[model samples]
Target: MTKPLTDQVVLVTGGGRGLGAAIATAFAREGARVAINYLKNKGKAEALAKDLGPNALAIKCDVRATDNVASMVREVTETLGAPTTLVHNALADYSFNGDGRDDLKTLTPDHLTSQFETAAIGGLNTIKAVRPGMEEAGFGRIITIGSNLVQNPVVPYHDYTAAKSALLALTRTAAVELGPLGITVNMVSGGLLRTTDASAGTPEAVFDMIADNTPLRRVTTPAEAADSVLFFASPWGRAVTGQNLIVDGGLVFG
Candidate 1:
């Protein structure tokens, strides 16, 4: 029995845990060889690769560094074949506790720069490294994990939201250029996820409030958001590019 993504190879950054892990799992389940990229979570990444069987590999690399990203892509290509799909899901260390976050008054340029370095610059590094391979293969899928907060900003996670907003601009611009080479770049943004490492610090009451406001009456899960990523990589999204799919159960419609 042939699977939809049989023979496909996918590289997911920050894939050791949380939503990255979920997205990697989804791709592996779809019969694609998966490479899980992580910065400091080796144990979790290795465990996931083991659980996902021979089709998965965990590689460590900081996406913020161009050399690191390029090296990681080389390793993935050598081990799993050149990745035809790339998911830029790596995020900087951030806690969702509103009390812990820097508000506009206290937020400094360093804080914003750190987020931009990880979310936007990191994305560029990875894309540049793997794009050549995708061009050679004449097929590619680039899915960026974003936040619905970029549009809603209900919580005003200023730095995080601002970084994602920059990512959206990059996504759209890349889509325009890559679409001609069989590469489709798109984004999947979700509201405060039920429980990701970044969102774990969020208050339970906050989650309930978001759920109450959503049409589905529930906060979206990492797995649910991950499925939307599959759509961009699947044949169904062959013609779709430069699109942002909000997967927060109808919380923010665009």
Candidate 2:
């Protein structure tokens, strides 16, 4: 069996654990050289790279900083090859507890900016870093993790939702600009994953509520969502770009 990603070098930011880790594993399974980028949690990142075997490496970078992102890409290229695929999964520290979340009155610009720094701005940094290599090769795939909350906003996670929305807009516009160069930009939006560090704080009741209401009768798993990200990178997705693929098990319909 042939895998389209076998010849590719992939950089997955914030790929030390949870959904990011799952995405790295997916790429590794396809025989792609995987660079697991992490800002902290060195042990988790290294452990995952080791588990992915010889072709994968763990790297560190704060995607919000262009210089750091550039350096990170250099290291990845030197070690793994110029990254032809990038998944910007790095997220700022945040908890998904609705009760503790900032409402309009309590929400400050700082709160939103913090999320934007990692989600929106970080997405920009990675894309720019990889643009030259992708343009040179005339082939690239850029996938950014997004949130279904942008459309549903059931719980009103203002900061998080706003940042993801911005990323989605970027994905579409970048797709247009990069299309001529053969690089496709897309977003994969997932609802509260069954369990991740970010969503672990959610009460079990909320999970049950989501499951009971979702058409699939279950919450989306990190691995399941990771597979959707895979679709946007594979050859089958070469013609698809600037589209947001929702992986929330039909919980929120468009």
Candidate 3:
């Protein structure tokens, strides 16, 4: 749809560290000028931008706040040109430890709210910010990071899974509305990744068990999942939209 990766400006939310960082790195590797958005990990973001070369930059923004997101997009546009690609990878402070997660009765509304703010509302803000630029150019690529738990909730991550489900809904609906404008919206869902700051609390035994059960016999890594995100942003994905491609090493199938 848009020009090749070398001619694109890409913005990735929560791109300072963990899986977000991996996704940013992937875009940079493909020669895209990338904007790394971070809420708290400024140091990491700056360092990543530096390592990615002059085509990349680090910006601070809280995607949950619409105003903050608008400012960040403006900065990216000013610094790297209007972003023709976007990746909604921001995540609330969360852990994947099933034992420590709240059960159905114990989960609070606030938990759901926090997750929804980041996964859904944050996505809404970023998408809106970039849509205009994409529409002007008549081409855009949008990819959201989701979780396979929505389809196979093996650990019962109620709040996190619920929010991700809503994001999936947003991704599909946005695709339906944006497709005519030459914008493709899709999602890349991953199961328990081997290691990310968010999943560091996950027990070693859990990883081993997941690896044993997965058809690949190994937990997916951040880079592997990041690669899937890249595919959706490339010309190869021009015909695909409103779809969630699970990148969990075949742990669970749709």
Candidate 4:
């Protein structure tokens, strides 16, 4: 196929499994050196790296910890080269249970804080870690994985949705500030990805409902979501930034 990302180093946080893994593999397939960052899944990360061949590196990092993020970036830069594309796909805690999806009446500070820490703060830390290299190269692509729950608010994942909304705002703000440096920030928001560990706890009825409602009549796959992210990183999207591309099979149209 095409090697648009040839000689480029791409870091994907939380890339051991699920959506992150898909994105990492996609980057590697396109000829970018891939750094797969995982907080706990070292085995899986290493496996993915090996599968991706010589250009892939696996690094353990908790994005919530700025020091860890910095070190992870340093290692990747030293080993793989300076990262021109950073995909902030790390999530601290992800649960699909009904308990965490309560409305405002039942929302707790802990719930809000945890979500923000993972989705917003984690993204900020990852970006900060790689930004200097991107600046020096005069090119960068920051693609944050978001959720369609932020737009439609279907099942009341209040804290999660709110955190993603904050991330989207950060994406826009970063785009504006980094545009002068030829860096672009964007978000790819997907809905109810099917068969991932993160969605294992979701009720079957919920999945059924979403599939029925979505125009495509099916839940998304991690691979499908990864395509949107690849678009942002590709040369085709050089002039596109500060935008959220909803890839929910046309679930939320506006």
Candidate 5:
């Protein structure tokens, strides 16, 4: 049997660690050439590439910078071939410690902007950088990592949730525009993934509460969420576009 992504090239931003790392590994497992993009964690990214063997490469680029993003994509194309799949998983530095989070009143515009720059604008940059290649190839898979909080907002994470919400809108709009180009743009929203770096600061009680509320009685895993991403890139999702797949163990419907 042929691999689902054989001969495919994938670029995963912020793939140095955590959820991004898991996504990159999943793609590598599926026989895709993987480019792991990192901002500051060169050591971790290189290690992951090495672990993934010859099919993976470690690249350093700040996703929020358009020039850097363009350069990164160009390098990935030259090294691994023009990416047929792009996963925008880069995130601004944030800890999921609700008690220590900035309340609504204390939330500044800069804080929101920072999150938007990394989450929304960073995705925009990657999409733009890869659009030409995808359009020329007439096949593309664009997956943005989102949060289930946009649907439930249970934690009131003002900046992060707001930025992801905006990303959802962009995903839909891009889907409509890119669909005709034979490219599918979608999002995979996972809730409180177990043990990701972003969620490491979450209290144990909060995790317990989330697990109790979910139908599966457990939080989603990054590897599990990564599977959904693979779906969009696979032939199985050929006709699916502009949709969000919530992988939070039934915590949020639709």
Candidate 6:
């Protein structure tokens, strides 16, 4: 296989499992040295790193904290070389069960704040840490993981959806701000991936409903969603910035 990302170092936040893990694996397959960051799940992260060979490193990082994110980026730079690609796939601590109990009235400020802190603020922190190194190299690719719920708010994952909506806005602004430095910012918004830990609690009926509604007539997989991230990281997406590429099997077209 041709290695398009040869000699590049990529960092993926929340990369121990689920969509994040898949994204890390994809980058590794493309010959990029990968730093897989996980808040917990050290065993899984280490195992993935071992599986991906010498070029993959597993580090624990809580994106919700700026200090942790900065430390992780520093470690990556010192050990694996400065990261030219960053995939912000972290999510706030929240379950995916859309029980309809968290509407505008029932949702608490804590919930919203926590969500924004991780998805939006964390993204900003990561971008800031990586941008300087990328600028020094004159090349960068920053991909933020968003959700299709932002486009079609039918699902009542209020906190998650709202956080991702804000994340999309941040992505656009960052793209404009970082464009002059040869860095590109983009978003990959995917629908409910079937077997991720985040989606394990979702009701079966709700999953079925989403599958039925999707033009593809099936729920998406973590691998499928990860492919979209890889696209943004690839040379093909060099000119694509400040755009949200929805990867929901045509479920929510915008």
User: Backbone clashes per model, in order?
Assistant: 0, 0, 0, 0, 0, 0
Measured by TM-score, how close is model 6 to the native structure?
0.95
Off by over 4 Å in 4: 1-3, 103-106
- Judged by lDDT against the true structure, how good is candidate 4? 0.88
lDDT of each: 0.92, 0.93, 0.94, 0.88, 0.93, 0.89
Give me the overall lDDT of model 5: 0.93
TM-score of each: 0.97, 0.98, 0.99, 0.95, 0.98, 0.95
lDDT of 1 at 51: 99
lDDT of 2 by residue, 1-254 (tens): 11288998999999999899999999999899999999988999999999999999999899999999999999999998999999999999988998888899999999999999999999999999999999998899999999999989999999999999999999999999999998999999999997999999999999999999999999999999999999989998988989999899999987
Give the per-residue Cα lDDT of candidate 4 at 145. 87
Candidate maximizing lDDT: 3
**Ten residues in sequence with the least summed lDDT for candidate 1:** 1-10
Residue-wise C-alpha lDDT for candidate 6, range 38-127, written one tens digit per residue: 887899999999999999999998887778888999999998999989999988666787674477888899888999998999998899
> Model 5 segments beyond 4 Å from truth?
1-3
Span of 10 residues, lowest total lDDT, candidate 3: 1-10
lDDT per residue for candidate 1 within 149-221, as digits (tens), equals: 8888877789999999999999999999998888999999988887999999999998998899889999999
Task: Indicate whether candidate 1 or candidate 6 has the larger lDDT.
Answer: 1
Q: Model 4: how far is 147 from its true place, Å?
A: 0.8
lDDT of 3 by residue, 1-254 (tens): 55788888999999999889999999899899999999999999999999999999999999999999989999999999999999999999999998999998899999999999999999999999999999999999999999999999989988999999999999999999999999999999999887899899999999999999999999999999999998888877779999999999999888
Instruction: Write down the worst ten-residue block by lDDT for model 6.
Output: 1-10
Over the stretch 1-254, how does candidate 4's per-residue lDDT look in tens digits? 11267867899988999999999999888889999999889999999999999999999988988998999999999999989999998876777866545678877899889989988999999999999998888889999988888888767888888899999999999999999988999999988888677888888887888889888898888999998899988888888999999998898984
Q: Which candidate is the best by TM-score?
A: 3
